[model samples]
Target: MNTSRGYLVIGGLVLAEAALLFVPVAILGAAINWPESLDFAPSQALPLIDGQLGQVRLGYGIYLVYSLAWVLIGPAIAWLALGRDKQVGPLFVVAVGLICAWALARAIGIIRWLTASTFLAETYAAATPEMRQTIDLIQSSVNAWGGAIGEILGVSLFTVGWLVVVSLIILRNGGLPRILGWSGLFVAPILASPVIELFGMEASIFISTLSIHLWLFAAGFMMVGMALFGKEA
Candidate 1:
């Protein structure tokens, strides 16, 4: 494809990524209160999941697909960055690796919601008292581990690391506008800030997540503009 077409494809992919994110957010937020619901104890959460099993399946299943798309997006972003600066060979590999790792980790984390959590929720409703205790313990462990992998590692660490690396490349190469790079750099830290919550500290998780969406929207539009205007900065 020609340069313009190539950029248009990547830009479309980026915007689609932003749009995909909204689907699960809206579905889960409406269905079960989602991220907050994730904090509920098993006694509280399982019943809710069992009650709205259909929505849980739909929301988390879509989320899994969205996370997997990150693998494709990593290469698309790397291609754009390479167009600006071909010298970032090793870093390019690392960035793509991080994105793929994030994708896999995210899938691992979300799979439980669609599969194990559902099973446990269904069983929890009919289990004996002893079995209920067992289910509760299992649910707690599952959520803790899954949350760490998906939220801390995939969402915060790998995502921020990829953005920081790509933003630096953008800044150094002067391929696109420098402001786009700086905007990404600014949002990267905000994304990372939520990781501090693991240490029992208060963090603005909602704001941090909103920042990610904003950055994606801004970056998507900028790329689409570059495609239309055929600008190579």
Candidate 2:
């Protein structure tokens, strides 16, 4: 029973990842765009409340909280997949660590927005002109440090490092399909995205966001399917 339950626990994590991809899908269903501009710089913090969340807590707050969920848990699926086969290696361990960093920094960005930015939004409409200065300063600092640097670097490590490493191992070492192996490699922009972003290609941010989430959905389901089939095998 203990053995059976262990697999079940890992499987649930993957399933959770797959489900979170639909958070955006559901957004589209409701005629909302993906929260593209929500990554507001500090100067643009006021819009977080008025712009994205649309002057309501329930609107944007729920989305950020949902993001924090998968960002925090999605990386663990990789480790659980490796452990399921009892094939733990130093390289894969390193990959998992990068994923953890990716998840953590992204979550912190969201948390900062939820806490500090939302506070700004809630007070913006009511604050005196003199009070706006203090609010803007705090928002600017947090937005720059928290969102711009932290999330960007975390994603850079994830896209350039872990995705490549995991894909290579899956293709050459794991006994998976050659096409899926090849497909995994296509997910990251190899020589572009992360590297080019350093020189200033902001579009890469959107690309990475879409690509990474899709990768999570794909990777998660692959592990869950493997785990289930392996159980019967």
**Best candidate, TM-score:** 1
| Cα error of candidate 1 at position 31, Å | 1.8
Residue pairs with colliding backbones in model 1 are 175-233
Model 2 agreement with the true structure over 78-185: per-residue lDDT tens digits: 444343364768767767777666666666766775577777877876788778888878777777677554446666655456667666656555533344446657
Clashes of each: 1, 0
The best candidate by lDDT is 1
Error of 2 at 175 (Å): 4.9
Model 2 spans with C-alpha error above 4 angstroms: 1-12, 24-36, 39-85, 190-198, 220-233
lDDT of each: 0.85, 0.57
